[model samples]
Target: MKPGIRPAHRPVVFRDKAADLASPTRSTMTGDRTVTWEDGTTYPMADVEISSASHPFHTGTARVLDTVGRVERFERRYGRGEAR
Candidate 1:
């Protein structure tokens, strides 16, 4: 990709419908859906399933699985915990 010959960067908003979040940025993605921003300008909207707003890592809502329990269960069935 050439530096100056790249695709045009236009104002866009990647919207996460599930999280009801919209991030305004510049991108080359175009969509049929248009949205009115706070500035009263309409921009292209790209609907996404997940974003930083709703992601477990960013939102700090991730589930912590119990790996210790699984390990104990495996050792009980295979008799491997004593080898260490």
Candidate 2:
């Protein structure tokens, strides 16, 4: 362990535009913009494309892909000789 070898960790705000959410966290990342938190504290702003607030899984909006149909089509075309 050495002194002054670690990068500066500062307060940052990660904003999710789609969900209109902002979370304050400490990170070593830097940004050119700033944003105010709910507590009226200003911090470096980092725009994120997606977050738990807007993610399908987190929001329970995720849909199962149509894999069953694709599998049925493949089996019909290839013919499951051993199974049939």
TM-score of each: 0.77, 0.81
lDDT of 1 by residue, 12-39 (tens): 9899987998989999999999999989
**Candidate 2 TM-score over all chains jointly:** 0.81
Model 2: per-residue Cα lDDT over 1-84, one tens digit each: 899999999999889989998888899999999977778888999999999999999999999999989999999999866955
lDDT of residue 83 for candidate 1: 46
- lDDT of candidate 2 vs native? 0.91
TM-score of 1: 0.77
Model 2 CA lDDT for position 26:
92
Q: After best superposition, candidate 2 residue 43: deviation in angstroms?
A: 1.1
Q: Model 1 residue 50 lDDT?
A: 91
